[model samples]
Target chain A: MLVHHLYSGGKDSSLAAWILTRLGYEVKLVTVSFGLLDNWRFARETAERLGFEHQVLYLPREVLEKAAEIAIEDGRPNNAIQFIHEKALEALASLPEVGRVSDGTRRDDRVPLLDLSKARSLEDRFGVAYIRPLLGLGYKTIRELTERLFIVEIRESEELEKADYEVELRHIMREKGLDPLEIFPKRHYQSRVLGWREKGI
Target chain B: MLVHHLYSGGKDSSLAAWILTRLGYEVKLVTVSFGLLDNWRFARETAERLGFEHQVLYLPREVLEKAAEIAIEDGRPNNAIQFIHEKALEALASLPEVGRVSDGTRRDDRVPLLDLSKARSLEDRFGVAYIRPLLGLGYKTIRELTERLFIVEIRESEELEKADYEVELRHIMREKGLDPLEIFPKRHYQSRVLGWREKGI
Candidate 1:
């Protein structure tokens, strides 16, 4: 079996991919770029270290910005993040060999969650199974697994600017004279995987 | 500093007690019994294994039943559980050596949660600090820590009839011809810690 995994190079996504590999599936890591200021090099490096086949798909900046505008208009980032997430799933599901798509979404994830309605729609429209192997796992479990699997370097989301598309969207919103706090709450802890030491390296 | 810890002999409470001990507090494990079908022998055994000073406080069945009735009337178990939990805190706060009270409530716990208002009142009225070290730690972390610290046996909430006070309360309500299901939702996961392997055993 082959699974197309949405890779963000973060602990959750990496763990999700690792789980797929453990489940006897060949995982093709798919990273969606929203044409932000991101180079997505960290994700590429993680895929290399983990020794997986990887691909990067690009989405138009206008599409992402439009989604962000809708979220900002509604005074929330949830809708915007969900929109981008749905788009990424759609893109991954479009792959020819991808009969199944997976992500590292845990039970506790809020913003990037794919609602049941969207998931049902994807399964119906694309005939692709959506899987979240880490759905019931918690932050501590993910961190524990990551620590054991890879020698990882963690950086705050702000420090790893390109890791999250929201950073670019927030920057764009700021340029438009809109306060980012109005759309997104503060003190949310998000981290990016900078690089990793191979096991025993 | 001596802390009174509300214990239930479950993984969460045991882990909470373990955390408090590590943090250098003199932990007095306090288990509240609602005069139900429980002697709380499991809690006593756990306290003994963990080497903590243990106390079992009794709350009148009428008091607990009344709270359940109110919650049934309100169509929610959250309020009823919180009421019982607050009463437990109030009782523990009255102890002279107890400058602080803590619980094993985790981030994902719904019922028996201390709302902001109740927490504030506890602090303002009793001048006792209410702490939940497991507040932000999720289910996985608690279980992992429990597994690491002690050899544990887990039993389902239904299987361990006397472990949770809610079971007896539900029985009482059932006797009153009120369907407990209407008040308390089904498939709630609660557990009893049967025994733990000694450090060297």
Candidate 2:
């Protein structure tokens, strides 16, 4: 069985991929780019370090434009990221080779979250299985698992070089002269995976 | 890391244990009994077949009594089962050797479901992590996975011998001369795990 995991070179998605691999599924780490920036290369690099097959799929530039508009109008990023996340998942699920799709969305995630109804609808529409291994793990548990399983670098959200939609969305926000820092919450930390932790370390 | 998974000898929980085991956690399959019946032995049999360590934990009989009262008063089993599920999780988390807990609850399950707030509260109070591997999987995906991994026996709910709290709770309902059929939905199916599937089968 093959599982496509949305990759952002981040702790949560990396751990999710590791779990699927352990569970006897071949995992393909995929990063979606909006064609606005080359940050998707970060995820590709992490995938290379993790020794998994990696690919970057492109979504239309307008998708990020609409998401940025939503963020600027709402003065927040939750709905905007969630919107792009759905589109990305749809694009992944529509692929002929993709039968199972997963993401790093956790039980405590506010943005890029997929509720049960939407999840079921996605599965029904795409004929794909949506798996979220971290859905039941809370914030503290995820931190513990990531620390035990991976080498990660944590920094402020803006300082982190990652492949998530926020990077591209923020780029558009800047083009509109709206500072993303004003919209996104302060003190947010983002983690980028460096490599796997050795056993007995 | 050790995770104590609430075992019912059913497909959902058995699959959860399999996932935790594959993820490098030492899983102890624990079946909680209200001391009403010996059905927990069914779980012990499956655990033995899977070659995992298993135990039977006894809860207070009064807990079932209260749950039965709630079921009879409300004419439904969702709230009653949820109440007992919370108590069972608390008991599991309270074990000194236990640092993490998990269950078979799925995304679409109405009864015995733990919402985010309660799950977090359980973790905070017990200083343990709660993991639900099946939390994001819907009915179709669960059925597909169980079929691929386990040889299961499917039958009417009442015909299935299981270790879940419902078995004992229904016993209490019968003692009250209440037909559990009235409280539980008709035409429900339950599955018991026979064993694991071969690698190529």
Candidate 3:
């Protein structure tokens, strides 16, 4: 069975990838780049190291806004994070070679707000299975598996900004005692902002 | 400031109590028993050891059901989790001496979902500031603090279940195994259902 583990290059995402691989599932890694994640490269590298084809689905402005709106309120910052998976499900279902999309959804995610069937149904609109492995495990368990596997270089949320994940932090704290840039150091890697200028939200 | 740190003898709640204490706040730990939490004694003991005024909030059936109907999803389990907090918050606010309510709301909790201004507005139509000291800190930091401070006994989420936390594991096998107790285990923990012949659920 092909488990397209949602490989976000974070600890939980990578751990899910590792567990599914050990289970002998055909594992693939997928990342949804908000076009500004601080850990984009780490996510990409980990997926590559895991021997999975890494794909960065650009999160459009509208999608990020919707997801962030929920995340901020839900305290589960990726409240609609699985929407990224939904998009990936849509992308892969169109491809003749791939019939399934999988992810690394966890059990103790405060709430299992994401429904894979939502992705599956959205994909079934195109007739494909959206799959997820390690969905039943907690984040603590995911952390244990990641450490046990000895694959640790992961990204932080701050890595999302292209100019510097510090872009907004700097802008907001220009007059404060601490430089926002110093507080939140910039990430080395970068990604294209497809929707930034036109939408300007 | 009187930080009424909400401690449910749970890690996040207790750690929140400790963090504020370290920052020079006079912390009074509050533990609410909604009745179904089977290990109320253990929680009481932990609170006593920590030397905080541990208070147990009684969850009346009508109030819990009112809160539950609003917070829980119709088909899915565990929606009662948020309402449980709502009930706890109401009880916490009713204390005569409490000026401001503080909590163990950590980086991990959906603080926006539990915003006291929102809860208070809907709840008693009164205002209380709900403060979280470790709002932006990571779980690992909290784990480290829990150990370093000996704030309370470090227990997993299993402690909250009227049944064992592992019950979710078994329940998962029977159900879709999609969510861990569908969020929080739906224990009849002191919901006026357990001791007698009448159907509580």
Evaluate every candidate with DockQ and list the scores.
Answer: 0.03, 0.71, 0.02
Identify the candidate with maximal lDDT. Answer: 2
Q: Looking at model 2, give its docking quality level.
A: medium
Candidate 1, number of clashes: 0
What do the candidate models score in CA lDDT, each in turn?
Answer: 0.70, 0.86, 0.47
What stretches of model 1 exceed 4 Å from their correct place?
A1-201, B74-76, B156-161, B174-190, B195-201
Which pairs of residues clash in candidate 1, taking residues 3 or more apart in a chain or in different chains? none
CA lDDT for candidate 3: 0.47
TM-score of 2: 0.94
Q: Per-prediction TM-score of chain B? A: 0.84, 0.93, 0.63
| Candidate 3 local lDDT, B9-44, one digit each (tens) | 655555566544543357776655444444455546
> Model 2 misses residue A41 by how many Å?
0.5
Higher lDDT: candidate 1 or 2?
A: 2
- In the range B1-201, model 1's lDDT, one tens digit per residue, is 677889877778877776665444678888888766665666787778767778888877777888878777899777777788888889788777767788887656777877556765776688777767565444444554566567665445563444455666676777788888888778745555555544411
Candidate 3: misplaced stretches above 4 Å? Answer: A1-201, B36-38, B67-73, B115-125, B151-201
Identify the candidate with maximal TM-score: 2
Tens-digit lDDT track of model 1 for A84-160: 88888887788787778888776557768765566667766887767666653344445555675665554444534
Model 2 local distance difference test score: 0.86
Point out the worst 10-residue segment of candidate 3 chain B by lDDT: B192-201
Model 3 lDDT per residue over A1-201, tens place = 564545555555555555444333567666555554445565676555556667665545555455544444454423344454455456655666665555555544533334433543555586555434344333333443445454343334343432211232233334334344444334554332121111110
Native interface contact recovery, all models = 0.00, 0.73, 0.00
